[model samples]
Target: MHVFLIAALSADGFIAKTVDQISTRWTSKEDAAFFAQKTKEAGVVVMGRTTFETIGRPLPDRKTFVYTTRELLGFPPELVEATQLPPAELLAKLEAEGYTQVAICGGSQVYTKWMQSGLIDKIYLTIEPVFFGTGIRLFTEEITNTIRLKERHLLSDQTTVLEYEVLR
Candidate 1:
């Protein structure tokens, strides 16, 4: 299955101002539309518990698999499922369920874990105009890898989307 990490970052390289901050508040509408379109095409999105809680609901027309040890309340199992499965195992399970691709929608730890697994095929980043100065980063820990740029799009006058192929 194709697994890609997608996120919108501030020009300073922060994903959000804080753990509970909603991305829509800082990211452009064009970026929001881009995220919806891509993840919808992927048919499934995987994120951490903090990211899931920040959104407060499962994305429409997609199966959301959240990485969490405890149950997430007030959501159907089909629409939103909590799991502890590692990246590869989860992707394999999703593939068996007929999903050809998966989106690693994030919050630090989740992104780090998937990248560390070396299962990420690509990365899509929307860089917005503003800077948070310091906040939650895309990955909580250090990461070193080479990725060649595959595509770029101007989401707006100030926002740009960069797509890169992982060079493992």
Candidate 2:
């Protein structure tokens, strides 16, 4: 299975203004269209509990998986499949279930955890044009591994989309 980290970040590398809030300013209509297209192509999508909560609901037409250690209750029926498994076990189970591509959508800690585990294969980073002086970063720890840029697309509003493959 291939794991990809997909997220939009400020120029300074912050994914959100805070842990609980989604960065609306950085997310444009073009970004949403691009994400919807990516989401349509993905077979499975995985995210942390906080990310799920922040979004308020699961995405339609995709098999969404939420990674949380705590019990997830009170969600709408068939909204999305929620699970509380560690990264390795979850990935193993998904692979066993025949999921080929998995996208790791995130907050910050989840991205850090999966990146540190060396499970991520590719990353799609949307670099917004503005900078947030204080906000939640994409990763908590510094990564020393080299990530090679595979592709890049310039958006209409000057936002750049970068694709990088994580070198093992």
Candidate 3:
């Protein structure tokens, strides 16, 4: 299976102001449409517990999976499938279940964890036109691996979509 990180961020590389706050001001309608289209292409979407909580719930159209050590019995079962395993084991189980593509939707901690684990094959990042100097970063300081840009698509409103391959 192919694992990829899919997120939108400020040009300065921050995903949000905090784990619980999402800055939707910088996000354009075009970006939203594009993201929805791309998200639909994936068979499965996975994220951390924090991200799941931040977003409030799983997206309706796709099969959503959340990684959390805590019990998720209280969450709506129809919208999400919760698991407690680490990234590698989670991916292995998904692959064993015959899932072809998995998208990692995030908050910083989850992004850092998956990136550091070398479980992500590609990343799709939408760079908004603004920057937040005090927000949470996309990756942790421990990630030292280099990523090669495979492609870039410039949108009409100065926003950009970057596709990168995680180099080993």
RMSD of each: 0.8, 1.8, 1.8
Q: Estimate each model's TM-score.
A: 0.98, 0.90, 0.89
Model 2: per-residue lDDT, tens digit, 108-130? 87888888888889999998877
lDDT (tens digit, per residue) of candidate 1 on 1-168: 899999999999999998899899988889999999999999999999998999999999999999998878999889999999988889889989999999999989999999888899999999999989989888877787778999998888888999999998
| lDDT of the candidates, in the order given | 0.92, 0.82, 0.80
Q: Choose the strongest candidate by lDDT.
A: 1
User: Which residue pairs does candidate 3 place in steric collision?
Assistant: none
The model with the greater TM-score, 1 or 3, is: 1
Candidate 1 lDDT = 0.92
Q: What stretches of model 1 exceed 4 Å from their correct place? A: none
Evaluated at residue 162, the lDDT of candidate 2 is: 96
List, residue by residue over 1-168, the lDDT tens digit for candidate 3: 788898888888888877777445567777777776776787678888887877776676877888788878765675688886789998888789777888888777778888888888899899988778888888765887689999997866587889999887
* Residue 159 shift from truth in candidate 1, angstroms: 1.1
Q: Give the TM-score of candidate 3.
A: 0.89
Error of 2 at 46 (Å): 1.0
Clashing pairs in 2: none
